[model samples]
Target: MYIDGKWKAGNSDFAVTNPATGEVIGRVPDANEHDIEAAVAAADIAFADWKKTTAYQRSELLYRAWELMVRQKSQLAELMTREQGKPLKASLNEVQYGADFLLWFAEEAKRMYGQIIPSARENQRFLVHKSPVGVVGAITPWNYPISMITRKLAPALAAGCTVILKPAESTPLCARAMMEIFDEAGFPPGVINLLTVQNPSRVGEVFCTDPRVRKLTFTGSTQVGKELNGLAATNMKRVSMELGGHAPAIVFPDADPVHAAKGLSLVKFLNTGQACISPNRIFVHEDHAEPFIQELTSRASRLKAGNGLENGIGIGPLINELAVGKVDGQVKDAISRGAKVHTGGQRLTEKGLSGGYFYAPTVLSGVTEPMRIYREETFGPIAPVITYRSEKDVIAMANDTEYGLAAYIYSNDIGTAMRAFEALDFGIIGINDINPTSAAAPFGGLKNSGLGREGAQEGIEEYLETKLGGFAI
Candidate 1:
C-alpha cells in the first residue's frame, strides 16, 4: 500500500486471487484502522499545499500522468484482466478510458471558473471562488477498477484536493499498478494515498466520520451507498455517489431489429453485465419481440467464453463464486416463476474451464414484472426480455424501479424517440446508442441510484466548494 507519500507494506497482508481461475495472483496489505488514519492524515497534510499550487502546475502533473499511463497501458490492462476477469481488449479500453479522464480533466483544471455576481450596492461586487473541499475519501469497486479509480482521482486532483483511495479487495493489483504510475509521474508526496483492505465498511466508517476528510466519493451498490451517505451526514462531509442501476433498453416495433439487438447485446453483457450502467431489462414491442429474441439468443450463443487473456474470447467469467451463484440463483428463480429460458441459463461446467467461475450468456423470455430478475438488479450475463403492447405501458414499466441511472430507446421515429427521451426518468438516456458514457459527458444517477455525478465539468465540481467574496474595488 502507498500512503503518506510513500510505498510501504502493511502489518498484515491479504491475498488477491484471480476470479476466473481462483488462483492467488498477488497479495495486498490489509489496512487496519491505524493505516486508514495514517492515509487520511497524509491526505489532510497534502491538501494545503496541493490546493495552493497553481492550476497550471496541477494540470501539467495530470498531463504527465496521462502520458505515463498511455505508455504503460498494456501492463495496466493485463493487470485489470488478471484481477477483474474482463477480456483483454475490454481491459485495454478501460485503461484508455481511465487515461482520457486524466487528459480531459488536466485541461479542465485550468478552466475551473468562478462567477462574478451582480451586487445590490454600487460600490460592492460579489465574487464566488471555487476551492478544494479538502481531503477526499474515495472508495471504488472491483468492476472496472482502473477506470473507477481514475474517474474519482482525476477530478479530485484537478480540483486540487488530495485523496485517500480504498480499492476493492477483489482487484487490488490494478490500483497498485496505477499508484506505481502516479509515483513515476512525480506527483508530490501525500497527494494521493492507496489503502487496500478487505473490510470496506470499517474503513468507510473511519474515513467518513473523520474530521480530516471533507469529501467522500464512492462507487458501489445502492445499499452501501445509503450507509455511506448517512455516515458522511454526521460530519456534514460532501458526498458524491455513483451507485447501482437496473437500466432499461426499450426496442420499438419500427426500429431495425438486427441493429437494436446488436446494440442492446453489447451493453447488456459488457463487463459480463457487471457495470452499473449495463442495461438489465429489455422492453420490445410485441410485434418485434420474437425476431429480436431469436437474434439476441443467436448472438449470445456465438459468444465464446474463456480466459480474458486469451484471444477471441468474447465473454469472460463472473468475478467470483459468489457472483456466479447469485446469477445462477436468479436464473433458477426466474425459471420457477414461468420465465422461458431461450438459451444458456446455467453455469458452464465444461472440462478445462471448470476451475474458473464461468457462466454462459443467458436470455429469458415471457418474463413478467413480478419475477426477481424483472425488477431487481441481476448484475451478471443474464438479460430478461419483456414484451409490451403499448408505449405508455412500456414507459411506465421503465420508470417503475427505484433505480434511474440510465435508459435506452431504439426507435426510427424522431417523435417517438423524443417522447421516450423526455418521459423516461433516468440520468443518462441513449437513443440507438448502447455505449453512452464518455469522459466528455456527465455520468451519474437519480433517486436511490446515487447522488451527484462523475465525468465532465460536473465531476470536478463535487470536489470543490464555492465561497462568495464581496469588496469595493
Candidate 2:
C-alpha cells in the first residue's frame, strides 16, 4: 500500500492469484478501517497544498509519469496479464490506452479556463472561476484495472485534487505498480494514496461519509453505484459513476449481413466479453438473419481460448469460478427457453485448460425477451441473437433494457444511420463502428447506466467546482 509518499503494511495480507492458471502470483496489504481512515486523512491534508499549485506544475508531474509508463510499457503489460487474465496482446493494448489518459490529461491541465460574464447592471461585472473540489475518493473495478485507474486518476490529479484510491481486490498489483510510477514521478506526500483491501465496503463507507472528501468517483456495477451515490448524498459530495451496460448492436436492412456480422464479431467477444460496452443483445433484420448468424457463429467458433500467456491465444480464462458459473447459467437458461446454440455452450475443461475457469465462446439464436441473457448483463463470452422486422422494431428492442450506456448501428444508408444514432437512448453510440470510446471524446451513459462522463473535456470537469464572483466597477 502507498500512503503519504511511503510504503505501508496492512494489519494482514491477501494473496492475488492468476485467473488463468489459478496460481497465487502476488500478495498485497489487506487494509483495515484504520488504514482507510489514514488514507482519507492523508488526502485531506494534502489537498490544502495540492489544490493551490498551478495547473502547469501539475501538468509537468503528470507528463513525467506518462513518460515513465511508456518507458516501462512491456513490464506493465506483463504484470496486467499475469494478474488480470487478459491476453498479453490485449494487455499491451491496454497499457497504451491507459497511458494515453495521462498524456491527454497532462495537456488538459493547462486548459482549465474560466470566463468573464457580461452583467445586466452597468456598474457590476461577473467572473466565474473554476477551482479544485478538494479531496476525492475513487473506487475502481477489476475488469480493466489499468485503464480504469488512469481514467479516473489522471483527471483528478490534473484538476489539482488530492485522491484516496481503492482498487478492486482481484487486481491490486496493477494498481500498486501504477502507484510506484506516480511516486517515482515525485508527487508530494499525501497528494495521492492507495489502499489494497480485501473488501471495499469499509473503504467505500469512509469515502462516502467522510466530510473531508468533497467528490466520489467510481466505476463498477449499477447496484453498487446506487449504494455509493446514496451514501455520498448524505454529505452532498460531487459524484461520478460509470456503471453497467447492456449494449445492443443493431444491423439495419440496408447493410450487408456478412459485413455487419464481421464488424460486430470483432468487438462482441473483446476482453472475453467482459467489457461494459460489449454488445449484449444483437438485433439482426429478419431478412438477413440467416447470413448474419452464420458469419457471427463461424467467427465465434474459431476463437482459440487458453492461458493468455501463450502466443496466438484469442481469449483467456474468466476471473474465477463464479464468473464461469454466471456465463454457464445464462447459456443454459437460454437453451432451455428454446434458443438454439450455433457454437459452444459448455465449460472448457479439456487438456491444458482443466485448472482454470474457462468457458467456450457461444452464440445462441432465437433468444427472446424471456431469456436471462436478454435482460441481464452477461459479463462473459456469450452472444444472444434477436431478429427484428423493421427499424422501429429494432429501436424498440434496443431500448427495452434499463441500461443506456452504449449502442451500435450498422447501416450504409446515410438517413438510416443518422436516424438510428438520434433515436438510440444510449450515451455512447457507434454507427458502423464497434470501438467508439477515445481519450479525446466524452464517454458516459444515460439513465440507470451511469452519471457524468469519463474522458475528454467533460472528464476533468467532474473534479472541479465553479464559483461566481461579482464585482462593482
Candidate 3:
C-alpha cells in the first residue's frame, strides 16, 4: 500500500488470491484505523498545496499519468484479469477505459469555469466559484477495479483534491498498479494514497466521519452506500455514490431481433455479468419474445468460458466461491419459483475448471415478478426474459425494481423509443443503443441505485464545493 507519499506496509497482512486457481498471488497490508488516520492527515496536508496548483499543471500531470497507463496497459490489464477474473480483452478495455477518464478529465480540468451572477445592488458584483472539496475518501469495488478507481480518482484529482483510495481486498493488485503509474507520472507525495484492508466498514467509518475528508465517493452496493451517506453526514462531507443496479433491457416488436439479440448478449454477459450496468432483466414484446429468446439462447450457449488470459475465451469465472454460491442460490430460487431454464443453468465442474469458480452463462425464461431473478440482482451471467404485451406494461415492469441505475429500450420507431425512454425510471437510459453511459456522459442512478454521478462534467463537480463571493464594485 502507498501512504503518506511512500510505499509502506502495515503490521498485519491480507492475502490476494486468484479466483480461478484459488492460489494466493500476493499479500496486501491490512491497514488499521491508525493507518487510515495517517493517510487522511497526509491528504489534508497535501490538499493545501495540490489545490493551489494551476489547472493546467494538474492537467499536464494527469496527461502524463494517462501516457504512463497506456505504456503499461498490457501489464495492468493482466493484473486486472488475474485478480478480477475478467477476460483479458475486457481487462484491457477496462485499462483503456480508465485511462480515457484521465485524459478526458485532463481536458475538463482546464474547463472548470465559474459563472458570474448578477447582483441586485448596482455596486455589487457576485460570482460563484467551484473549489476543491478538500481531501476525498474514494471507496471502489473489486469488479472493474481499475476502471472504478479511475472514475473516482480522475475527477477528484482533476478537481484539485487529494484522495485516499480504499480498493476492495479481493483485488488490490490493480489499485497498486495504478498507484505505480501515478508515482511514475511524478504526482506530489500525499496527492494520492492507497490502503488495502479486509474490513471495509471500519475503513469507511474512519474515512467518512473524519473532518479531514471533505468528500466521500464510493461504488458498491446500495446498502453500503446508505451507511456511508449517513456517516458522511456527521461532518456534512460531500458524498457521491455509484451503487448497485438491476438494469432492464426492453425489446420492442419492431426492433431487429438479431441485432438486439447480439447487443443484449454482450450487455448480459459482459465480465460474466458482474458489471453493475449489465442488463439483468429483459422485457420482450410478446410478438417477438420467442424468436428473441431463441437467438439469445443460441448466442449464450456458444460462449466459451475458460481462463480469461487465454485467447478466444468469451467469458471467465466469478471472482470467488462466494460469488458463485450467490449466483447459484439466485438461479435455484428462480427455478423453484417456476422460472424455466433455457440453457446453461449449472456450475461448470470439468477437470481443471472444477478448481475455479466457474458457472455457465444461464438463460431463464417464463420469469414472473415474484421470482428471485425478477426482483433481485442476480449479478451473474443469468439472463431472464419477461414477456410483455403493451408498452405501458413493459415500462412498468422495467421500473418495478428498487434499483434504477440503467434501462435499455430497443425500437426502430423514434416515438416509441422516446416514450420508453421517458417512461423508464432510470438515471441512464439507452434507446436502440447498447452503449448508453460513456466517459463523456454522467453515469449514476435513481432511488436505491445510488447518489451523484461518475463521468463527464458531473464527475468533477462531485469532488468540488461551490462558494459564492460578493464584492462592492
Cα lDDT, model 1, residue 232? 93
Every model's TM-score: 0.99, 0.99, 0.98
lDDT per residue, candidate 3, 1-473, as tens digits? Answer: 89877999899998998887778889989998888888988899998899999999999999999999999999999998889888999989889999999999999999889989898899999999989988999999998899888899999999999999999989988899899999989999999999999888888988777778888888998888998898888778888888989999998988987789889998899999998889989888878878889999999999999878888889899988888998999889889989998899999978578878999999888888887778788789999988989988888888888999998888999999898888888999988777786789999999999989889998898888889999897
Model 1 TM-score on a 0 to 1 scale? 0.99
Candidate 1 lDDT over 283-376, as tens digits, reads 9999998889999999998888888999898888888888988999889989999999988998986956788999999999988977888878
For candidate 3, give the lDDT of residue 309: 85
Q: What tens digits encode model 2's per-residue C-alpha lDDT throughout 62-142?
A: 999999999989999999988988889999999999999999999999999999999999999999999999899999988
The 10-residue segment of model 2 with minimum total lDDT is 261-270
Runs in model 1 deviating more than 4 A are none
Where does model 3 exceed 4 Å of error? none
Q: Per-residue error at 129 for model 1, in Å?
A: 0.8
